[model samples]
Target: MKICVIGLGLLGGSFALGVRNTLDDVEIIGVDKNPEHSQKALELGIIDKIMTMEDAVPQATIAVIATPVNIIEYQLPFVLDLISPMGVVIDLGSTKGNICKAAEDHPKRARYVATHPIAGTENSGPESAFKGLFRNKTMIICDREKSDPIAYQFIKSIFKDLDMQVSYMDSVEHDKHIAYVSHLSHISSFALGATVLDMEKSEKSIFAMAGSGFSSTVRLAKSSPAMWAPIFEQNAENISEALGSYIEHLKSFKEIIDNKDMEKSTQVMNRVNDIRRVLKGIDIKS
Candidate 1:
C-alpha cells in the first residue's frame, strides 16, 4: 500500500513512523509546504519519499490530510478530485464539522472519511514525531454514513494497525463534545499561561517557584498557534458555550472563598474530585 501524508509536521510525521513500524510492504510519500519540514522528515526516515500533491494524490492508495484545519478545508476538495476511484482520503483535523461540510456535496464525497484522532503532544515539527503516538488513543470518525463502505473499512484498518480505538459520531456532535473535552482544556491552559506571564512582570521569582503542577497545567499553551487558531475559529460557538460555563463555575468558587465559606469550598473541591475516577479509565499517554 502507498500512503500520501500531507503536512509533514508532528501528526503527519508521527503517522508515517507508525505506519512504517506496523505495516508491511508500504510506501509512505510526504507532502509539506515547508521545505525544511520535508527535508527533516526525510532525514529522520519518517517518510519513504517526498512528492508534490499533484503527483502523490493520483498514485496513493490512501491520502491523509494532516494539515491545519484551514488548509484541510482548502485542500480536501482538490484532493478528492485527484485521487483514483479506489483511493481513500482521511483528515486528522481537530475540528470536523466545517471540514466535513466542505466536502459534503463533492462528486467523490464517498471517497473521503472524516476522522479526528484524540491524541497529540504540545510539540510541533517533524523532529517531534514518534512511534506509538496513536496507540490506545480514541479515533472519532465523523459522519461515517456519508463515506463509502470500502473507504471507511480501509481507514478503520489503518487505525487498527496503529492500535487505536475507533468510534463514530455525527460531525456536529463531535464538534460539540470536543469543545468541552479538548478545546476548552487548551483554552484554559493558554489562559493560565498568560496569567502567569503577566504576573511574572511583577514577580521575577515566580517561575522559580513553579513546580510540576504549574508545568503540567500550562503545557498545552506551548501548542502552535498556526495550528490551533483555525480550530478555535471553526469551533468558536461550541467553545464559547463551554467557556461560559467554566467561567460561571470559577466565579462561584471565588465567591465561596471570599465569603470564607469553608464548607462550601470543600464541597466544590470534593464534587470536582470525581473527575479523578473518570480519568482513571482514560488513556491519555502519547
Candidate 2:
C-alpha cells in the first residue's frame, strides 16, 4: 500500500512513523512545502521517499492531510480530486466543522474522511515525531455517514492498527466540545505563560522561583503559533464561549481570595478535584 502524508510536521511525521512501524507492506511517501522539513523527516526515517503533492496524491492508496486546520480547509477538495476512486483521503485537522464543510459540495467528497486524533505534544516538526504517538489515544471521525462505507471501514482499520480507540461524533458537536476541553486549555497555558514572562521583564525574578507546577501548567505555551493560530481563528465562536466561562470562574476565585473567604475557596477546589476521577481512566495528554 502506498500512503502519502502531507505536512511533515509532528503529527504527519509521527503518523508516518506509527503506520510504517505497524504495517510491513506499506510504502510511505512524504509531501511537504518545506524542503528543510522533508530533509529532516528523511534523516529521521519518518518517510520512505519525499514527493510533491501533485506527484504523490494519485499514486497513494491513502492520502493523509496533517496540515494546520486552515490549510486543511483549502487543501481537502484538491486532495479528493486527485485521489483514485478506491483511494481514501483522511485528514487530521484539530477542528472539524469548517474542514468538513469545505469539502461538502465536492464531487469526490466520499473519498475523504474528516478525523481528529486527540493527541499531541507542545512540539512540532519532523524531528519531534515519534512512533506510538497516537497509541491508545482517541480518534474522532466526524460526519461518518458522508464517507463511503468501504472507505470508512478502511480508515477504522488503520486507526485500530495504530492502537487508537475510535469514536464517532457529528462535526458540529466535535468543534463545540473540543473548544472547552482542548482549545480552552491551550489558551489558558498561553495566557499564563505570557503573564509570567511579562512580569519577569518588569523586574520580578519569576523564573528563579518557578517549579514543576508552573512548568506543567505553561507547557502548551511552547506550541507553534504557525499551527495554533489557525485553530483559534477557525473555532473562535466556541472558544470564545469557553473563555467567557473560564474568565468568570477566574473572577469568582479572585474575589473569594481577595475577600479572604477561605471557606468558599476550599469548597470550590474540593468540587474541582472531581476531575481527577474523570481523567483517571485515560492516558492524559495536553
Candidate 3:
C-alpha cells in the first residue's frame, strides 16, 4: 500500500511515522506546500519520499489530509475527485463540520472518512514530530454513515494498529463537545499566558515564584497560531458559547470574593472541588 500525507506538520509527520511503524509493506510519500517543510520531513525520516499531489494520488492507496481546517476543506474534495474508488481519504483536522459539509455532495463522498484524533501538542512542523504520539488515544470518526464501509474499515484498521480506540459522533455533536473540552481549554490557556506575561513584565522576578500549576495551565498557549486560529474561526459559534458560560462562572466567583461572603465563597470552592473529583473519576490527572 502507498500512503501520501498532505501537509508535513506535526500531525502529518506523526501520522507518517505511525503508519510506517505499524503497517508493513506500505510506502509513505509526503506533500507540503512549503519546500523547507518538505526537506525537513524527508531529513527527519517522516516519509519515505516527497511527492507532488498530482503524482501521489493515482498510486496512493490511502490519502491522509493533515492540513489546517480551511485547507482540508479545499483539498479533500480534490483528492476524492482524483483517487480511485478503492482508495481511501482521511482527514485529521480538529474542526470537522466545515470539512464534512464540503464533501457532502461529492461524487466519491463515501470514499472519505472524517476523523479527529484526540491527540496533539503545543508544537508544529516536522521538527516537532515524534513517534507514538497517537498511541492509546481516542479517535473520533464523524458521520460514518456517509462513508464507504471498506474505506471506513481501512481507517479503523490503521488507527487500531496504532493502539487507538475508534469512537463515533455526528459533526454537530463533535464540535459542541470539543468546544468545551478542547477549544475552551486552548482559549483559557492562551488568555492565562497573555495575562501572566503582562504581569511578568512588571514583576521581573515572578518566574522564580511560578509553580507547576501555572506551568501546566499555560502550556497550550505555545501551540501554533497558524493552525489554531482557523480552527477557532471554523467553530466560532460553539467557542463563543463556551467562553460566555465560562465568563459567567468567573463573574459569580468574583462577586462572592468581593463581598467577603465566606459561606458563598466556600460553596463556590466546593462546587469547583467537585470538578476535581469528576476529573479523577475519568482517570484524568486534575
lDDT per residue as tens, model 2, 1-286: 9999999999998899999988879999999999999998988888889998989999999999999999999999899989988999999999999999999999998988889999899999999999879998999999999999999998999899999989999999999999999999999999999898888888677698889999999999999999999999999999999999999999999999999999999999999999888788663532
- Can you list the residue pairs that collide in candidate 1? none
lDDT per residue, candidate 3, 1-286, as tens digits? 8999999999999989988888889888999999999999998998888889989987889999999998998999899988887899999999999999999999999999999999999999999887788888889999999999988988998999988889999998999989999999999999999998899899999889989999999999999999999999999999999999999998988998899999998877877787877667545411
Q: How does residue 220 of candidate 1 score in lDDT?
A: 98
- Model 1, span 1-286: residue lDDT tens: 9999999988988888998888899999999999999989999999889899999999999999999999999999999999999999999999999999999999999999999999899999999999888999989999999999988998998899899999999999999999999999999999999999999999999999899999999999999999999999999999999999999999998899899999999998999999998788894543
- 13: Cα error in model 2, Å: 0.4
TM per candidate: 0.98, 0.98, 0.96
lDDT of 2 at 231: 99
lDDT of 1 at 83: 97
Worst 10 residues of 3 by lDDT: 277-286
lDDT of 3 at 72: 95
Candidate 3 TM-score, true structure as reference = 0.96
- Which regions of candidate 1 fall more than 4 Å away from where they truly are? 284-286
Could you tell which candidate, 2 or 3, scores higher by lDDT? 2
